[model samples]
Target: MASSSGLLPSEPRTLPSTGFQVVDASETIEEETLPGYHLGKYYPVRLGEIFDKRYRVVGKLGYGTTSTVWLAHDSVESRYVALKLYVANLNNTRELKAYECLDEADEKDHPGKTLIRKLLGSFQVDSHSSNGSSSHLCLVHEPLGPSLKEILDLMPPYSFHLGFLRPVLRNILIAVDFLHARAGIIHSDLQIANFICDVRSSDKAMFAKFENAEFTQPTPRKIISEEHIIYTSRRMSLSKALPLLCDFGETRLFSEAGTPGEDIMPNVYKAPEVIMHMEWDYKVDVWNVAMVVWHSLTGRPLFNGRSADGKIQDDRIHMAEMVALMGPPPLRFLERSTRMTRALWNEDGNWKNVAPIPDITLEKLGADINGYDKEGFFLFFRRMLRWLPEDRPTCEELVYDPWLMRELGLGLGR
Candidate 1:
């Protein structure tokens, strides 16, 4: 399939119809590890490429900030899988180790694989057209559907009901709990994009149909951007499907109570402690899951830092928004925090930069969880959205929440 220049083949190459524009797979593309790689750029993978002589890339699935996921046919398992190829020296060793911890836990009592995406295997692949270039770290995972935000995009304005919202959101919290308690890892980047629709097929023909399913391919959907994408529609019952929590590049050990993380999470979903540089632990995950729940209910971001002019604002704006929705940080919280104190308050406990956060009650959040599901939703919501991390309910406690049980009717914790 060589073209006249002998680089790209003249034969037409198939591209994903996922809507995001991509370079022709046949174009002369440089690997990210190449000498002249640019920011916000990655090597465009071509179809029919083989990884470690086992998985052959056939279609494009999606793209993340640091990697690109391809639909590959697994010769070993005789099934379709996803190959997440990362940039060279991307510091993914820690993430792999975290997965190992999860695997070890799964081998014992907890079934972490059922909650998060299954890590099939990992291997390395040589770069394209780079003479003697280093191999890229490729993570092999089970195939999953579009992300939660993607499904939300497909819904009409506020079309998602509490019935769908409850189950899906609870499942995400369950996955987060797995990472925090069993795995002992902090999913520093917990957001809607990191959650994918959980679905799989074993039938060869059926799997093939799934491999070629027409859906919006996610590109340009930057993980940390202020905007949310609209998916328009989905081919399956997204609510009935589970959510697979993926991406662990920012993961870390769930430190002891007083130990702090240097940096973690995107600005919008970031916890006050994390943003303010205070001691944080698994509670950051708790804060993020609350934001995820709100987004699920409203199909709008719970907090955004961008200005009305579409310009990205500073982190102070995010803090302002949190204060607006959740009310001000507790005085004890203010006392313990240095960065936030200097940013928002003076020594006399007087407000400086922060505005008085107005009232945005739970009932106004959506349809109010409705007649049968109000208690469960509100109780869980109140417990999880606390200003103090210590005040927030642990994942274990949230599991038995009346709201999740009664509202979701999930029989999750019985």
Candidate 2:
């Protein structure tokens, strides 16, 4: 029984009590007064409001610097969907174009397709307030559960067991492979936050329960003024635990190879080629996968890229760490970036003492792994962590690596 204006049935003439708690204006709520936050920039979304004449807002999911995400019920499809509303006047053409590329790709039969989050639809909404009118871009997507980072936070050890980590890694590699080989897209930003868990079964029931709770026990909020209200975000329960690669805002379309000198990726996960300002390609993503594996298994970052005080990131320190762990860059490799080579190394290709290289090795860092599988694990890392991008294995090759598939009973007798 969908209403003409929305999916849910019409509300009663006399609305029921919301039972919402109001907070003082001075109290901080979700995304209130954060950097870049301004009135008329973000669309003032109200609970129970229907957008695009169909999807009804259930509750706030979360907010980022550029956008706010909400859980909504799609009346036409009779299912729950997530709505990402970008700040007014923000340029989101890159992300939209990436989705368009994915939609046009002829890889429907690819197994990795299911591991990537699907974009449902998109539209523009005009907001009118006392200040002015602004148009916001809204993207509709399939609802998902918590991110891998959030899940890790709940774990006491903040790390995943090998059994749990294996499948997640395999699925991520498959998804990356699909993006590279089929879509010709490179997801430049790959991190724990972008790896979200999928909500597969019992989705309807779960969303319905969430909507009902919003009606009976509304989320607390702080009303700043007549036009601004900050509501606390509601967290969804864990789902089937399948990892989906998300966030295409930084994705680049590659026809043959990547464009050099383009700054991408978080500082900590940056590849050597990226650090040296040299040509990079899909292998940069291979380097990212290695860092992710190290973080997930060790519960700590392998590279912090920090200065002496650790208050800011310094490339010299970061490069020095790589030297300590992987040894000096080959002269052939140094020739790729003459400027960086001159700054960090002597003419004879020896360390110029720009920064003190730490005394460390991969074996010492990963010594905590059990004796039986330690060798295999480091071997897998060596295949991807090479200073030369060409030396690193591709996502497809790493998917079949002996270490990742050893306990899963895959890649046997190879």
Best by lDDT: 2
- How much does candidate 2 score in TM-score? 0.90
| Model 1 TM-score relative to the real fold | 0.78
Best by TM-score: 2
Which runs of model 1 end up more than 4 angstroms from their true locations?
Answer: 1-41, 106-112, 128-134, 200-206, 210-240, 256-261, 354-362, 365-376, 407-414
Each prediction's TM-score versus the true structure: 0.78, 0.90
lDDT of 1 by residue, 108-160 (tens): 55444577887888987665442334457889887677788778778676435
Candidates' C-alpha lDDT: 0.65, 0.80
| lDDT, residue 107, candidate 2 | 82
Tens-digit lDDT track for model 2 on 253-354?
Answer: 886446567789888999988988888887788888888888887777788779889898999899999888888888888999999889989989998888
| Model 2 CA lDDT for position 340 | 84
